[model samples]
Target: MTSKLTTGRAGIRRGAAAIATAGLAAASLVAVVPTPPASAGVGKAGASPQVPQSPPLPQSTQYSADGWKARPEQYDGMDIERDVPITMKDGVKLLADIQRPTRHGKVVPGRFPVLVQQTPYIKTVLSLPPINWALVKRGYVIVTVDVRGTGGSGGKWPVWGEPEHSDGKSVVEWAASHNRPWSDGRVGLFGISYGGINQLFTASQRPKGLKAIAPAVPMGDLYRDLVGKGGRGYLELAPAYLAAVSGLGILPNTNLLKDPATALKNIQEHWDAAAGNLKMIPEMIQGGDRAYDSAWYRERSPLTYVDRIQVPTLLMGGEFDAFQRGTPMLYQRLSAKGTPVQFINGPWSHAIAAIPAAGVSLPGVINEPPGVKLGELQLRWFDHYVRGVPDPALDRRNKQVTYFENGANQWRTARQWPPADVRYQKAYLSGQASKGRPGALGTPVSGTPDTVKWNLFSGLCSRSTFQWLLFGGEFGNGPQKIPCMTDNRYNDQSGLTYDLPVRGRPLRFTGPVNAHFTVSTKSRDSQLTVRLEDVGPDGSAIQLTAGWLSLSMRELERGRSVVRNGMVVQPWHPYTKASQKPMPKNKPVTVDVEIFPASWSVQPGHHLRLAVQTGDFPHLFPPFPQLKDSFGGDVKLWHDKTHPSWITLPTQPS
Candidate 1:
């Protein structure tokens, strides 16, 4: 915290101030004493958070906990069979790499619980299943498959289309029945990102013998989570990811080596498939305005059919992840239904999701994001749910919710998300910009309206760039990490910034944030971008999380929004074309934008900031059709007695 090196968004993580918080223990939970305020950071007062790292992923690490490392590996080595083809109902062949424990370089004579990960990314690039030695050695069967029309698999990539849904059920049944020699009938699903999401699709089918799933960093709602989060399209990530996967789809799969003639035909099929998906790239932008939240996304998002999935589920999420909104939503829904579930959320972004992995280190390394190893935790989860091994760790009463509080730099356990102790507090927008400073956040007052040009590159150079862009083999630290993730001063300049008056008292908050604004626009529509940040004493500000909303989609689903302690803690929105409404030019419109959740503490010298913009691009932009409605024009922000614009933050007790 004392470094004051806030040049990059990924700058210093350690905090100089200290605050007391509680930590979760293996068998119990207790209060933790204050430590030096080296916190989760980026900005003026922090040194670069990037750190040197190498070696094993967390899934392969051994934990120091009592029963964690106690289970010895049943086998010494592993046997991997690549390009194992399984025929679907339509006669399309999907390729999978199967890994089993080996003894003396030979397959062990035993039936092991099967773990499956279906992905669109090339099968050779391992992440979701990680494909490390530690897992197979511990007496489990690991299966990684390239989804239809991708990798070595035959048929077209469904983009989570119809084929993709049924394909998961087929793959699960295939693993449980076709791989009988190594399978024990009991099966589980595990993977990160693409690999992670397919688990929801497959499990939702109520596939037989699929006992449990561990979907790490998966999106629950494709539309609200990533594609067009808060009614806006992901400008760079959607197309880039589609292109990356489609390009990989055409790679000469290893199947070409096994059968040259047949492989060539399939390779051509891959390109044919890629060509079909590539056409959707431009359509993504058009869909942003016209077809956003269309039937296409509803069919793909797991939220549409989550209730159908009854299996025990484990979710690992990043507070700064692209799917941060969806992760907790999934947890809340499942836990509400009294289903078996566990959610472990940390202070990492999309690419940095594994920062707490077994052998890695970055920020918030106190008790956890890792006290025991992440790999062992999964092992225990599956042991109880899938392998029929009774474990106390599986007890639902124990910390079902484990989260990392960044500024505190410690991982704590809770019975539920937003924990039961949370209370929402409102900070009204007040004052006006003077000199170089923007408006202030303080007690409600009838302040004169402020005007500024709509911001298109609102978060262009901030944490969000890192959160949505980086995918595989990415680290939160080091030179490879994007500088924007560490700082937000660049974007703050383009918007109307409001800072909570520095009260000289520490303030702690976590969970969802709702930014309510009363504004007038010259255009018929506008996009609202709100970022929740923590500003340092030296004027450097770092982004905690952000939210977006196209004005046309401002309508809220009031009955669906949650009210706790008399404040709408979490606002639900129907970002559908049918819900779209026209805004009157030069008239005030009430808009509630849901800020993605985060966990952090405002230290004594630091303050909280809410930066608001009229529009954002490269991060999220309206479709071409809606450009006329949202394209740049000055916006009027009103903070008056009749239209008191404010932000609601879920404050948590220390």
Candidate 2:
């Protein structure tokens, strides 16, 4: 009945050149490997009495443009070395590369408690050497560094995580006062994405001896991890991850590339001048007005330091993560401020949680089968929080919450985190015709339903004719039936479906998902989205979490709403502003739509779906085809029984 959609300067320059050639070929394959030294070890711990597993594969060895080195007969008991600098205290030296274990005969170090990471990708080649040789052959000392401006560090890069939280608290106070030889001043931090957002901005600056931190898919909130959800900017991950970290800050390394075909033509002309200066990121965040301005893009956000985090945190994420709502909003703001948090999620993406899960390998690194070992659960969480190891199985109050359900890949723990007993159900949307025909199916209601109609189209075409055939192109199609929710052939009754049906046992849902309903439009302001499916058994619906609003920024912020089991938690609503008046086309108004946190179970005859459309092609970036004031006319959809559409399940705990 009314519509508009934009975005197509040749599909935003071919999605910004396929995200800048897959982020400069993954940061030039993590900068040609070689960093390594600082104490490279492996033999000695118990001198060889035992512990010698990992090594059924991973030994391909092949690094030449001048690095990859390490061949002292391939170590035999393992102990390699390379460059290891660490000057800091404001003089800025950085560059680290340690790996431990050797202490002669039985490698028994005096003090041992360090696990830092600090990355700009390329700590001697996309590190993670079989989880740093299984945490230095099970002794732990690790290191890594190279932040402040990327490898061979110095300064000037500062791309994300609030200037790497004071350079990751000055590389954990210079790895706890260079006490070297595995000396302890206590430290722990791991990495994954931007070294897990510099371990949550150096554990939110609680630095000192640091204590513990894991970070995994962490990015926590640089405007919802690189501008997205609503503040929109994720045009395929910000100009291809800022032209692959500004083409790894102007290529070079291999000890400063001396020739090799003129250093691969000056690293492809500094990756085409950092992908042509990614259209001056909104004028460099409006001339860095400060707040750490890159154009005041919300002052390089981190959700403004979620209450300045306290330590003992873990926070991992993935629901095909692209920073899945900043890792559950840093585990719901560090477990609502009590700290000592945990929270994990799976069914990963974002480089499949740093490789390995297909068969699972670690004998040196390349058997590549295991996808989520997360470096052996971040070395048993930095060996029970930086080596005070009593190992009560990593007790951060036991089960803080964990998830994974790509058709049950297993691993599901929960003492809290969208698991209370789940039972919030609502499915309503009778049919009868109003704007574009076909309705009269009536009677099969449970909650909200009284109106539903849709039909919008304009510029940039394909506003999802079933997500352009279930996620466009290639052969990566697996979870189907989610294009227009059945009845095939792009059925569009302004699409609205809600199912529940189950029977007994097996029905666990997890956090964040909202929808409210009651809309009306013909054009003035429009955009609803809301997905949340599951379906299966033969009908195939999949797609578990999705949300987007824009009906003149919907409103709903006050105490942020809450209802639990019957669904409705609406908190996290940073729409910011936009609604001075624009909803006349037909006018109805109700808007809620949150949808993003997830953790499923379903089972027992399975069904739990919910879909409401307005458009979401290419994973968003459509609305704005001159509707001028955010279009929204003649587009009604309401749930019945006096508007009672619901869905809020985090239940689990017998």
- Please report the candidate that would top TM-score against the real structure: 1
TM-score of 2: 0.35
lDDT of 1 by residue, 1-654 (tens): 011111111321121111010000000000000000111111122232233211122232345443444366556666666677777778887777777666676666656677877766665444112233445767777777778888777898878777877878877776665235556567888766666677788888887778988777778887888778777778867777778778877878777878787678878998988888888778867754334777788888878877888999988888877788888888888888877898989766555553332112334432344545665567777777887765664573443898888776778788888888778889999888532477888789788888766767666666666666644224225422555556777677777788885565667888999888898888877787888888887777788888888888888988988877767767788888789887788889888888888888888778788887766667777776666777766678899999889999888765
CA deviation > 4 Å runs, candidate 2 = 1-114, 121-144, 147-193, 197-213, 216-273, 276-313, 316-341, 344-388, 393-398, 402-416, 425-510, 516-520, 523-525, 529-594, 597-654
Model 2, range 6-54, lDDT digits (tens) per residue? 2223553444434433332353212111122343221122222223332
Off by over 4 Å in 1: 1-67, 127-130, 287-291, 355-367, 396-399, 472-485, 502-504
- By summed lDDT, the worst window of 10 consecutive residues in model 1 runs over 26-35
Every model's TM-score? 0.85, 0.35
* Local accuracy by lDDT, each model: 0.69, 0.51
**Model 1 error, position 13 (Å):** 28
Instruction: Report the C-alpha displacement of residue 644, candidate 2, in angstroms.
Output: 7.2
Q: Note each model's CA RMSD in angstroms.
A: 12.7, 21.3
